[model samples]
Target chain A: MSRALDTVAAWVLGALWIAPLVYALWAAVHPEAYAARFDLAAPLTFENFARAWAQAPFPRYILNTFVLVTAILAAQLVLCTLAAYGFARFAFPGRDTLFMLVLVQLMIVPEVLIVENYATMARLGLVDTILGIGLPYMASAFGIFLLRQTFKSIPKELDDAARIEGCGALGLLARVYVPLARPTLVAYALVSISHHWNNFLWPLIVTNSPEVRPITVGLAIFGAPESGVSWPLVSAATLISVTPLLLAFLIFQRQFVQSFLHAGIK
Target chain B: MRIRDWATGYLLILPAAAVLAAFTHLPIVRTVRDSLFSRGSAIRPARFVGLDNFEALAADPVFWKVLGNNLAFALGTVPASIALALAMALLVDRKLKGQGVLRLAYFLPTMLPMIAAANLWLFFYTPDIGLLDQILGRFGLPGRNWLGDPATVLPCLMTMTVWKEAGFFMIFYLAALQTQPPELKEAARLEGAGRWVYFRRVLFPMLMPTTMFVLINAVLNAFKLVDHLFVLTKGGPNNASNLLLYYIFEHAFAFNDLPAAAALTAVLLALLAGLAVTQFALLDRRVHYR
Candidate 1:
């Protein structure tokens, strides 16, 4: 009896969870006339996707999203590695205070400072630029903190051995630290890519032109109040926008979940 | 070796520090300064007017309303999502047929972007023609205005948020559950304690740390995350759903009131700091047996 009850409850929750995705897939593939229809026999079509594609510059949006995510990840990897190295290995003055300040950024994000940051960007003439969109997120507190924790776990003897090999600081980092931290680096990269891929507000605030707008903002424009959104088309566009990340998750679901758990545990 | 060590360490950290200073630290300091000054216009010079922005905020009723709305949102979202997540985690943790598939299904929503979730829910809530109303019509029950009515807008937003967030939080609980020893649970069952009693007495105590983590994360998410508002409500029905972050966005970007936005931001920062301090203090006091 207890086992039956547990099975029933699990099925209900599972349905609640999977229903939306199934609904989205249905809406995206079905014709507008049949969207609300619950018939299993309803013929699925791809016309909504074609319409959604033509309605917006989705190809351009995907390209821009790719650029934004890669740029941010590249910058974060370089910056976080250095900062994590400093905090993990060095004995510099005010290191703890500096690390704390960086950690504080984890709690207070660029979204909160959008107004002042906008003015700064305007002043610097970076408004509507890809650099402006990606600038604030390039140095992530979460990344720095995560990498620092990972770096501290490595044995100090490794660093000493690298030094005995007459390797310079850069060499030691490139040859020793970076190689040792591959799993952590991959984990951080995955987390960063997923995050920036889904980011909206800062990018929306920074870019005014269609040329630079990422997929999130591009999708928003389609769904804006002024624009009349057909449900099927909107669903199709949403599916398009999320496809890459979704595909990535499907492929690396284990790594993705493990990375998040590892990051959280630290 | 020591010189090389110092150089390597400095080199490793330079790019990240520069980015941090340019983007995060410098902007925060600039925001503090900007909050003390009044904006002349969108493109014009800002003039220094120390604390006037804060004083104006104190007098504005909308500020309080939005703050209250945020509190209401937090209240509605955090506990509901956490409890739902906990329940789902417990359900899936059971040894049953097709449990792996069930776990994957529960976690699928977490992978979808918030913007997409918001857009989907917006469709779901559309009056007369939407799925929800269609379902209600079939049941002979009255459909709600959902996002269109002030009374229901916040709840509508909360529901969407809960759907998106619950699965993500469930992962944490699942991880914690995996680490829990099976002996205690089996021991409790052998004693003839009912499932609810075993859960309340044995399992719940083991999950306290996970609960605290989820609570802090949920509260942070409540304040900081408002992406769905852009598509769903836009703080609509006479600003009934105007959360603090959305209000801050509007003042700075729409109304071009930098100082007021900054002042509002300062308040948000203070509140976040207070929450963090309280979390630490509470954790310090709580004795985790596991």
Candidate 2:
């Protein structure tokens, strides 16, 4: 009886959890009339998606998001790699204090300092640009921390062997550390991509133009009160905005889950 | 050799360290400094007004209301999501039928952006023309203006937040569960301990470290997760569903009051600092345990 009860409970919860997305799918595929109604006889159409696409520059939003995520990830990998190498291999003065300073970003994140960050961006003349959105997050403490941990775990003999092979510090990092930390790097990239892809508040605050706004900010403006809400159209837009990440997630479901798990465990 | 070693270390760390300091650390100091000055305008420049912004914050009812709502949101979201996550973790920890699909269903919400989740829920919460109302109407229940009404607004937001958070937290518990020794369960079974007893004595204690981590994260999220507000309510119905970060956003951008935003940000910073200390301390314990 208990086992049966558990099965029923789990299934019910799962259904409840996924019901919203399923509703979104339904609304996107069908007309607005059938959005609130469950009608088996309702005709399905791609018109809503067509309307949603036409209503906004979703193509621009997609490109902007893609550029933003790529830029952020690339900057993070390079910056974090060098910093992690320093923290892992070097015995420098103030290393511990500096690392603690880096770790400060882990908690008091960029979101918390929006007022000053906005000012900083304005001072740098980066407001309303994709680089502005990605700049604040390029030096990720989480990335540095994770990479440092990974680098530290590598055997000391490997670094010594690389040195014996006439490997300079940069070359050693490129050959030994980067090659070995591939899984960690991939996991960090996945996390960063999804995060910046979904990031809204900062982008919303910083960018006023659709030219640089990410999909999340674009979706918010698309559904703002000024523009009347059409359930099917809104749902269609939501699906389009999320499809890249959502489809990637669905196809690479195991890798995505494992990446998140690896991130969380660290 | 010593100088070269120092050069290498400094050179490598400089890029990351400089950016972190400029963005994270310096902004904090600058926020504090800026808080003492009023928002400048075309007619007059920003002038030093010590404690004026903070005084305004104290008197501002919206600030208080948003702060209370944030506390309520934390109260509503944290324990509920953690409990659900724990339950989901336990359910999938065992050999269950189609558990992969079950896990996927629960976890999918966590993957979507909060803005998208808000857009989806906005459809469901729309009065009369929404999914919830249609279902309720079928069951002879009245419709609710979920986001429109002040009373139900924050709770509605909390409900959506809990849905987004629970699955993410579950993965952590799932990871923690995997690390537990199977022999402990076998020993408990041999000792004739019931499932509840075994869980209460063994499992719950073992999950304490993860619970602490999740708690800190939940609290931080309570402050940070205001993306939905932009879509759902925009802190409407007289700021009934307003959170601190959203309130800060409103003050900074909407009201164009940078000083007030800085004041509220100062409060947020204090709260985060408290949580950060607690998290780092807990993380230290966790590191030692591992």
Candidate 3:
């Protein structure tokens, strides 16, 4: 009896989780007229997909999002790698103080700093540029913290061995630490991609023109306050915006889950 | 293994340090500076006002209301999502058929972009011809104006937040559970302790550290997260759902009040600092126990 109850409860909860995604897929394929109607006989069509594609510059948005995510990730890799190596390997005056200051950035993020950042960008003449959108996020405290933890987990013997082979600081980092921390680097990349891809508020504030707008801001253009939302088109747009990340997740589902687990462990 | 390595490490870290100092640290300093000045317009130069912005914020009713709304949002979301997440972790941890599929399904939402989920929920809450309304019509019950009505707006936001956040939190609990020594649970069961007794006395105690971490993260996220609001509410229906971040955005951008936005941001920074201090205090106590 207890086992039966558990099974029933599990199925109900599973249904709840799966329902919304299924509903979204359904709405995306079905025509606008059949959206509210849940008839099994309603003919599913790709009209919404075609209309949604033509209605917005989705291809441009996709290209822009990819560029933004890749640019930010590349910048973060260089910054976080050096910072983590420094924290993991060195002793300097005010080292702990500096590290703590960096950690504080984790607590107060770019969103909180958006007001000051906007003015600063205006001063630097980087306003509405992709570089501006990615600037504040390039040095991530979380990435530094994660990589620091991963670096600490490595044994000193590896570093000593590399040094014995005439490896300088940069040489050791490139030849030894980078290769050893491959999993962590990949994990950080996944997390960063998903995060910056979905980021809306900062980009919304910084960029005005479509030239620098990411997909999240692109989706907001379709969202109308005056007219009631057309569910089919919105879902289609959503699917278009999210498809790449979702496809990446599906393709690399195991590695994605492992990365999340690894991030949590760190 | 000695101090020479530290010097090399600091050298390696310089570039990142410079970027962080310029971007993160300098902006904070500037934010504090700007908060004390009055800029009549974007074109006008800022004049020092010495706490005048803060004074104006204290007297402003909307500031208090947005703070209250943010507090209520954090209150509504943190404990409920934590509890739901713990329950989910427990459910998926059970030795059941197709548990992997169930786990994947529960976690699927967390992988999707927040904008996607927000757009999905927006459809769910649409008044007419929405799935929710269609379902309610069958039961002969009145459907709600989920985002439009001031009374229901914040709670509606909370529901979507809970859905998005719970699975992510569940992963932490699941990780903690996997590391727990199973002997205690087995021993408790052998002692004829009921399920609740076993969970409360053995499992829950073991999970306290994870709980504290998740609590702090969830609270922090509750304040920082306002993505859904962009698609769903945008501080609508008489500003009922105006969170501090959204409110700050409005003042700076829409209303063009830079000082007021800076003042509000200072308050947010203080709130965040208090949360961090409290979390460290709790974590310190946990360390002592260990």
Candidate 4:
């Protein structure tokens, strides 16, 4: 009896959890008249999506988001790899202190520094640029920490072998340490991509023009009630904005969870 | 050889160090320094005001209001999501049939951007013509405005947060649970311990470290996760649902008051520092126990 009760409760909770997305699907597919009605006989149409697409510069917003995520991920991979390699291998003065300073970013995130960073960006004349949106997040402490842990676990024999082969510091990193840490790299890349893709506050603060505005900011502007909230059209746009990540998560559900787990273990 | 090693190490670290200093470390110092000044405007340039911004913060009712709202939000979300996440982890830890679908259903919302989730919830919260109202009307109930009224807005937003976060938190608990010794469960069962007894005495203690990690994360998110406000309420109806970060965003960007924003950021930094200290203490204790 208890076991059956557990299953029932689990199913109910799951349904409640997924109800919002299902509702978005419902509202998006139906006409504005039928959005709240949910009548089975009601006809479904793609007109709402067409109208939503036409109303907002969603194409441009999507392109900006793509550029932003790619740039952040590319920069993070190179910078974190170099830093993590250094911290994992070298014995240098102030190394521990520097590592601690990097970890400080874990607590006082870029969002908290938005006011001051905005000023810095303005001074550098980087305001309203895609690079400005990606700059603050490129040197990710979590990524460095994760990579350092992975790098540290590799036996010292590998480093010695690579050095005997006339491999320099950068070459050894690119050839040996990085290859061994591919799983960590993939995991960090996945996490970083999703994170900066969804990141809103800093991007919202930095970018003023539509050219640099990501989907999140664009959606915010499009869906605001002041802009005339049409339930069907807004739902359609929301689906369009989120579908890429949602589809990726659905396809790679296990890797997504595992990557988050791998990232969080530190 | 020694100097060469130092040069190689320092060179390898320079790019990451430079960006971190420019963005994270320096901004912290600058934020504190800027908080002591007045926001320069067209009529007058910024001048050092010396604690005036903080004094204004104390006097500002909205500051206190948002602070209370953030605290309430943290209080509401952190425990509820942790408990729910634990329950979910336990649910999926079993060999239940069709559990993959259940896990996916719970986690799907986490994948969607908060802005999109906010838009979807907006449809549900629309007065009179929303999904929620329609459902309520079926039972002859009147619709209460979910996001418009101050009384309901924060709670409503909290509900969305719980939904969005519980699954993400569940993954952590699930990871922790996987690392547990299965023999303990079998031993407890052989000893004829009830499920609640086993969980309370055995499972909960084992999960404490994960709980602490998730708790700190949830607290940080309580302050950070204000994207829903941009769509759901805009801190509307007299700043009823305004969180601290969102309020800082308003002051800095909308109102163009950087000094005031800096002051608010300082308070947020203090709150984060408190949480960081707690995290460190807990981690230290855990390490000692091990």
Write one digit per residue (lDDT tens) for candidate 2, span B1-290.
88899889999999998999899999999889888998888999999999999999999888889899999999999999999999999988788899999999999998899999999998778898877888899999999998989989988999999999899999999999999999999999999999999999988988988998888889889988899998889888789998999888988888888889999999999989888888878878876555
Candidate with the greatest DockQ versus the true structure: 2
TM-score per model over all chains = 0.95, 0.98, 0.96, 0.98
What does fnat come to for each candidate? 0.68, 0.85, 0.68, 0.82
Runs off by more than 4 Å, candidate 3:
A227-229, B1-7, B41-44, B288-290
lDDT of 2 by residue, A170-237 (tens): 99999999999999999999999889999999999899998999999999999875699688888899
TM-score of 1: 0.95
Please give, for residues B1-290, the per-residue lDDT of candidate 3 as tens digits: 56777667777778778878877888888888889998766588778999999999999998889999999999999999999899889988879999888887878888777778888888888886667887898999888887899898999899888888888888889888898888988899889999999989888988888888889889998899888887888898888999999999999999888888888888998899899899889989777435
**Candidate closer to the true structure by lDDT (higher is better), 1 or 2:** 2
Q: Candidate 2, after superposition: displacement of residue B17 in Å?
A: 1.3
CA-based DockQ, model 2: 0.85
The chain B TM-scores of all candidates, as shown, are: 0.92, 0.95, 0.95, 0.96
lDDT of 1 by residue, B1-290 (tens): 66665565566667777777877788777777777888776687778898999999989998999999999999999999999999989988868899878878888777777888888888789888788999999999888888889888999899888988888888889999999988988899899999899989988878888888888889999998888888888888888999998999998889967678889988887788788787878678556554
Writing each residue's lDDT as its tens digit, candidate 4 over B23-126 gives: 99999999898999887778998899999999999999889999999999999999999999999888887878889999888777888888888888887888
Model 2, residue A30: C-alpha shift (Å): 1.5
As a whole number from 0 to 100, the lDDT of residue A130 in candidate 4 is 98
- Worst ten-residue run, lDDT, model 1 chain A? A90-99
- Please give the RMSD to the true structure for each candidate, in Å: 2.0, 1.4, 2.0, 1.3
2 or 3, greater by lDDT: 2
